[model samples]
Target: MEIQNKSAGRLIKLIISGFCIGLIATIGACKKDNIKKEYPQGSNEQINTWILDSLSRYYYWAAELPKKPGLGQSPVAFFSSVKNASDRFSQLYLPNQAGVSSSRSLYGFDYAVIQEPLSLEVLGLVKCVLKGSPAERYGLKRGSYIRKINGKIFSSSNVVALDQELLTGRTIKLTLTELKDGGYIDQPELNMIAGLTFEQPVLHQVIERGGLKIGYVYIDGFSAGMASTLVSVFSGFKSAGVSELVIDLRYNSGGEVSEAAGLCAMVAPGLTYNTDFIIYKGNKNGGQRKESIGEAATFDKRLDFNALLQNNLSLSRVFILATGATASAAEVVINNLKPFMKVTVIGEKTVGKDEASFLISDQRIPKQVDWEMYPIIYKLFNAQGQGGYAGGISPDLELSEFTLLPLVPFGNANDALLSKALDQISAQKVNAGLRSSINEARSVSQIGRILSDSHLAKATQSIVLTHR
Candidate 1:
């Protein structure tokens, strides 16, 4: 993720700390207009006053709010003042921007760009084309190389502008190209129309190397829809008689908390039904909650676990590929599973956030406030009472993604991250001494910033649960 520089007072601290907290309160309906008629239109200061009241009453750090924040301040400024100084994940966002984080309003084929291997050229790589997305209709496949958009060469300066246009607009033009004979050759341009799409988070495949059949699954996030998909993927692995597993979490920051538990229950071999999986401790005002290990019958969504039983790998150990972006519900998977199985982590250090946040919005005065607040509400601990990993969870073997620029396909044996995991599974040379040369000189693309912004939104709105 590309780091941003901000003023001492206003920091874009992208510290995501949480899992699913089932406190989703509905916001006032969005009208064709942005105006709210329930409350009389007042000066900007009056609006700020309403915001202050909401923060004081419901914010996790209500006690930390200053006694008399100047009401004359803008809502954003007042928000910054009332925020807990120590909390980096607590933040306020505009309602429109917040909508993007929700699965309901979100529609598009999610993709990201990367620097092409052995060159400074940036290429748009399709991360996942949603099942019914326009990208899919237009035949955009994974690993599709997008050389240009709207007749302009994709560069750091124009990527954000193009992204906003593509997401918000009805239609977008693209220019497809390929590198041939060390030169760019144009392919057919496409004009894709945006529509609703349900993303398939579980990507699976099987590999046999060095007399070991490995089941590889790349989970994008732990969305509610993915719970059953995970079961099916694991079932496939079981049917293939795979002896090992590799989970790729490089782009998965987090999603639903229940899904995390479901994944653990599916993979962990000998878990007793209804055992305490993890504990959540909130502030003095916010009581603690415990999540138990059990079948999908206990989940809010009631995910099917029939596949889980049929295809439980029950391996003694599993390999995970992660990066700094691996966090929240993703980290929860790693932390909670440690007691049950051997988890070999290979990649960079984790984001180190072991807390959770709630999606806090205001209806104190009924449509009086037009914003939402995501506040850090609780700290999470595993069954071993281990929490407060604010420095991030360290990897057992540290490797860099920069070693293999423009990442190869998920299960490709040559992919740096996957290769290292396979090596460990096959008991290859302990230290092959392959490291990335990436340093301060690297030029970050604008798409990188766009992705980080989206990721931060997803990471901050986690719901920390307490089970009894």
Candidate 2:
């Protein structure tokens, strides 16, 4: 996952506070065909009026909205005033703020903070580095450990204070280290500044082990028009005779529903244009809407349905690698496919966000409003009518990457989650580490607590809709 910054405000705040695993909320992001080109300069009074009106019409919990929130309040605060207590992902962004935390602040790397059990020293484990980002330019990578930022070393004591400086600091200097054979060796310092950078969301690899060719796909996020990219990638996997599939959504940020539908179309077999994909049960004004697999896959004829059918893996089962960071769109695939095939999820449970939202900029052309509101719009459901996963989707096999320590990059057989999935596929007996429910209860169970914390872990997912 790239160092993308989501307007997922609270997740980062709490993660930075405790060195706990964090999740971010985001959406497919809505865009109007023509709105006011200029930013709005409306008074708080006018903004609050618009906010209340919009929420009433489209908010999933419109019935729960407060009847009277003083219009004098700031828009951000005002929006929060009416937001349902149950709503976690509904957010209001000031001008240039994240509708989905736009790419303006991305640094092209992602990290997980850990407090090593033995030394009690905190460490930043580089989980991923996007190609061409400053982090990659400085040789940062997965499994690399950050011992110091600027000149301050990490300790169990100082983690809370060091949080924002790492992400929002003007310039960051990192002291890198390698964990080798029970000790750490200091490496050359890496210096860089966070800059605007982006990458193709999908990363794929073909692994051949014991005469079984497995396709490993780590999807960072689902973006609009990703179906073609998925088609091309899966076509390659098909050509190479890849038989099994492992989809790594451990770091997946939230993304678009249609794009998710497209990905599902290519992976799950025996689905036609009318096959059910997602059901949007909206507020009274917005009503329940069902989206078909083909409608989302084709995206107005931008993609060929036959092309998706051609690239379909048609496997009996799929292994989904997930964590608390796996967003709603990814979870949609996991839940919706259950009726059709077996979905074996590895690693920790999911972030448990099932609702969908869209960007609500001023609807008018040459709009009067300067604000963007991402309101909770619908309760999501699948074909079998499974919904209400607000507690998060539990993993079939409970696993944690942090348990083994010194996180390995994706696709490495030594990687904890990948190794577990492979073991299941090959019918290998669970290793001592895996077999002992006692051990899983010890480390992984603890991670489950941290990942499900009300503050640290949030269901920060929303699907962008082109229409109401």
Candidate 3:
């Protein structure tokens, strides 16, 4: 992650669009005196008005908003009331205590606090850990349980506070645990702090089944630096002569559109300097932008046509493991590849985030004010002019990881999702009983955190403003 000391105008111009979900100005710095005298300092209505003004201008569904939301309501509540009833991705975040720029940092680990099947108490389950992160250094691997945070039990109500604490505080204490013999066993306590960590976008391992080499890659999320990491991963896969690929995007919330294009260029039919990838279309208020899977996709490491071909798997079909967490830039991969190859999506349906968002802040306001808005600004489509996955793209093979208790490691053959993908490749008979079990569990159980907390887990505070 690059630490950019950005001016308000320059920050607005560098908008990057992705899954987790930004303005321009050269204006005089806004002093406190610039605000109206009639409104008392820090009044809820005044803050709410600022949010409403920005939403009315840039929100994708601005026309649908209520004319005058309740003035007395809390600023956060008022902001919610004005939002389009259907748009779940648009969000508001209070800036870090230091200032707005620190909002771009992540918690290092994406965990889910779920209901313990036996006790029915909320328990945190690790989803994905960034490589070399404090969480990883503290030995927080996927499937490990979190019993407490700062010695306080985490329930649905206080989870948001936990998130805020992790994001803003200098240090945090985590009581890690695990499920053993139908009971929670305490592990070592960890005192950790947030730090800038560069995540390895691609995690890969090859498996040999029936004389075919299957390459498995787990993409945590797509950020600016992932294109080169992907190239290296695919290059290794090519050298090893893998015949099939399984991409695990169950936790990918989305990032940089360019990086999405780069990954698609590698797997899609055309690997060249200028291959059309996807179309960016917005509402009546905004114009459209066309982007290609070309040189623009990979910033630092631009491979020539032949070098791209050498790294290509050349397979007609691939398997993707997705959940509601698979969204935005991740969905771009699924949607863009459909036209050229066979994309078999396994696991649950994705987060229907066909629309992209922008990070918009009132340039007139100074950084001391902690409010920022991310509103849906455009809809995405493949080259074929096909999109409208607002409800999310369904999987071809419907299975959920919730069916497997004590969630198995990434490449485990018995893991329901991966096993099904491998079964398809090996031509083995589908396990009807396992499929039925997963289907049954779908109605009653869930893999990760409570439904209320899922949205918070997916909201990336980084601004991806595409235009001024």
Candidate 4:
């Protein structure tokens, strides 16, 4: 009986051991599966190498590049230092960053430029701003002439180069020439310290022509919150029964794609649209695979059409004032709005750069690295599939000449372009026998006379300089 009991006990022990082994094997299988599915496809060793390489590259690039102040720090470290920095970076990397940033700077004259001859000739205006000082606090009024920056004569040819130099967080010395007695006479020399915080977008009113109220919204870069601002401005115009809108995207280097799309949504209204496309390549085994023609292991996702369709705010007429400075997101705005409305494109062709970029960091490699890449993951296409604008968007109503005006930075909208659009809108009203809802016919008649004045002809000549 004792022998039989001992045998039973041994049998039970063997069974328990088998069950333990099976449980461990099952757990191991699940762990392997999770790793395969959760991580981007690669061998364990290879992924480790890639990750390290990416992190190292990111660190090195940040250290070497001429980035914005406080941006050269480690991404991981930056996020750690600032609460919600990750969310900020995610939004910043998008194409709409320029517009968004521009919208944010709308409150103050964070930056200023000298209006060009055409700008002054067309609108009889010149503008500059109190850099690093708020417009209200410094008493830097609009329509002020920037005679010189740091004792150097300011001109259209050198404004861009000078602006770049000033962005280096240095004190800029300026001589102001206020517009008084109908001419620009030199005022006093003023010293201003510039910083990244001083850059802001401006919206200004130009001359009212032909009973039509005109406004100018100058965009320097597309960042976040631009779409909302645009919507608000247009909505205000609609409420006020304003007849025309002039969007000056001149000197605008592109930023966020989503912001561009958002702007398109506001302008185009009810159109079903797809602005961009993403192409993905993968193996049958659901692993990352290389493409023969393009970059390896990438996939494409087009714009969320449903989102855009739902937030539609269509405009009747959109006059895009562009130049060589309009690029990327700006180009996207121009491209997407073509189908839905009468987009009267004016100015020079845009910078042909529709491609998007991504920031990457991986640590599972031989070296820790992080980097940015302008990967052509997606192609931008209109309804017709024609995407290359290397030649830029040609204006439907071409100006006889072009001008380089440095208006009171971007905020002082009382300028030539807005005035011209207002004139055109007023002329349309008179020819069609349609009266504007906001203004009396008498006002319209007076504006018509002002628009037809011989001075306007001279202004037109000065604004449009023929460049072969």
Candidate 5:
């Protein structure tokens, strides 16, 4: 009923990552002289030339860029033509175009359309409600199930269509069912507008397990300010005298690499500014480059690694909670920190997005180039040269969050995944794990599947190298 999105000036700071280096550095700046505008300014041919220049220089598969390509097609079509057949994350955005889309439209919550194990009725289950978004303000609690959308019931056949409509919609009306005193109860119809500015969904707390105090934090997504946010949380964990830590990234699809690296440094033991973080592999023009923690730290102003280290748990081992939704920058934390510590991943396998991108556009004043490109520019490898999880990283202990229905919120002992992680920490040993990487997608007929988690969702959610 209340309008929250109308006043959102900086929209979706939560969804998209990396702000200080806000994609202002032009990928084509150095080679602008080499690129001559064959057509008039803002013309299709000229715009295509800019796109070509960017891809040719920075695209991971730059060698595949067409030399004698047609320039007459629209920019979007043109981008598709030249991109490598293997590239999945590349995207081109029109000016002011990315801002208004459903992706940026702050629905303020994320949900999974799951099938009731017995009744087999498809229902929309709220996975997480952004800390201060419209959904949370609407009294929509995590673990609540949606029975109807605008009075229409959910079925496998209609769930997918309804989700699409829900995303594109401005005002979303939903009838949700939640776990009450002991059973599910119908709540009143709730209406939310997808217009709030982005707010990162980061929640933290300290839990006592036996004699050890454990610091548990749920990181939903990574962005520019994410590191500084962690700095504060870790500072508290230090104050709490917590001995063990659990990072709940079950719903994080990832954002900026800088933010990801910041998290790595925050928890890993004996890490310094110069610690090797990532090795980037690209085509001819984009030669291989390695970045250290110090180098990656510079991209974000809020990431005070020194402060984070002061608050660091200094654990020799860690437990990371993941799922199919965990990927890109999120995967970076799991992969890159392995050498420095024993990283045990729990929950379902990750959505192996083994690549990172450069946010490309014309950074000139009164910009001549009107489109923005988020092309997969680098194959991200950790310090040990461990890359290529195209299928996803298998969990040391594989467990599905949807294994049980009417899920409780994160950090709740009733949560299957989080509970298992706590059990592992108590026993101080990981259970025999499964290494299978097959898709965890439920049966198509059983539940309407939405391409919600990682494994690609347009662009904008990946490990982006936004600045020089």
Candidate 6:
């Protein structure tokens, strides 16, 4: 009996030990799986490589080059002064491209007008005279292959280097391939001088239609000096007696917020406008304070509607042309102007991004890594107390399709959103004219009837001035 009991106990102990081992193995396997999923297989190494490469590029562009111009002070100052790190990096990556889009290459050559890739496909050229040297006439003709600038081959990898070399204003010798009698011929040693200038912001045109004069000003960006430029343009329109003005912000990715606000103030009616809704940060302890961000100096310079309306103008209506590219400061203009004026927003929805960010650098590490974190610093609301237009700004008049097939020119001048805005302004002008004529006639009749009454005449004049 004792031997049988011992055998049973031994069998139970063996079973329990086996179960414990299996459980531990299962747990270990799950932990391994979690670790694998968290970092993937080789993604951590790739991310580290990317970070290093980005830092290296930033150091080269922001640190090394600026020092030579007698402008840049220190590496720390360079990183701290950079407003938009990503944008600066993007410019370095595709030093030549005018703009960056998700579908296109990161960097490419831009004639400072349109963003385009460096390709065998040759487009048209500009015929502008080079500044400061009229005797040295230069023609940048289309279809000319930009073979090697300063004896270095042009490639995507070394495009930034090429850009840096060209920035020196040194004459570059190009080897071109000319199309001759349906055969390609190489032309060696074509000496061409390169001069760099800051990109311009003004796009102006006058469209006369339906016996009405309409003006179009497409502002692609609101950079420094934009406010002065806009003021000048609006003053011109005021002198020209333009019936209507179309402000096209279709591809405006936004810039200086102050400039945008200044532009809005020119047209906004009321003494004060709600540029953005202010938000306060709340803590678990129930403490709260107004959220502050960016360069403290620049924050106050942003648009204040009430201040803008203090200098009211005769401009009654404004046609705002927008698209997905209209964002940040552009959206601020749209939001602030909507309540006070006859704002006709005609385009696709805007890029809904209301919050701001600050750029931070960690110099404690050897890499001197710099990056930006865009926290929802503040929430913005229009006068009507609405926000979140991010999917895009819904067009007042939506078009069914944008692109037309090749060889099928299926669009009219009026079909464009800007053109449509012009039509609306023209119709409004006619209505306004009729109303003005009726008011004038009524005033004349009243004045004539009251001319004999001296006491009433003073009151009538007071009323006229006050109402007007």
lDDT of 6: 0.44
Residue lDDT tens for model 6, 1-468: 999999999999999999999999999998987662222222433333333333334321323222222122333343334423422112112124343221001111121111123223221112121223311243333113344556665554555455455445445554544434534355566565443444554767666767766667877566655766666676666556677667877656665445665676666544334343222222222222321111111244443333334333546777887765566667766775665677778867766655332232344545322332222223344555555554556778653112110001111233245545755766543232423322112111111111111111111111000000
Displacement of the residue 359 alpha carbon in candidate 4, Å = 2.2
Which candidate gets the maximum TM-score versus the true structure?
A: 2
Given candidate 1, what's the lDDT at residue 71?
68
lDDT of each: 0.66, 0.73, 0.70, 0.44, 0.74, 0.44
Looking at model 1, report the run of 10 residues with the lowest lDDT sum.
16-25
Superposed by TM-score, candidate 1 places the C-alpha of residue 279 at a distance from the truth, in angstroms, of 2.1
TM-score of each: 0.72, 0.82, 0.71, 0.51, 0.82, 0.45
lDDT of 1 by residue, 129-211 (tens): 55666677787765466777677777766667666655565667877666555555778888766566766656689988778
State which candidate has the highest lDDT. 5
What residue runs in model 2 are displaced by over 4 Å at the alpha carbon?
1-41, 97-106, 429-468
Q: Judged by TM-score relative to the true structure, which candidate is superior, 3 or 5?
A: 5
TM-score of 6: 0.45
Arranged by lDDT, best first = 5, 2, 3, 1, 4, 6
Off by over 4 Å in 3: 1-86, 91-107, 118-122, 150-173, 178-184, 188-196, 270-274, 295-307, 358-374, 429-456, 459-468
Instruction: Give each model's clash number.
Output: 9, 4, 6, 70, 3, 14
TM-score rank, highest first?
2, 5, 1, 3, 4, 6
User: How do the residues 154-238 of candidate 5 rate in per-residue lDDT, one tens digit apiece?
Assistant: 8877866787778665787889875445445778898777667566647888988778899999987777788878888988888
The sequence of per-residue lDDT tens digits that candidate 4 reaches over residues 379-413 is 34444455655455666655411222223234333
Sequence-dependent TM-score of model 3: 0.71
Model 1: residues with Cα > 4 Å off, grouped in runs: 1-58, 72-77, 91-120, 156-168, 295-311, 359-372, 400-402, 405-407, 428-468
Q: What is the lDDT of residue 10 in candidate 6?
A: 97
lDDT of 3 by residue, 339-358 (tens): 77899999888877787776
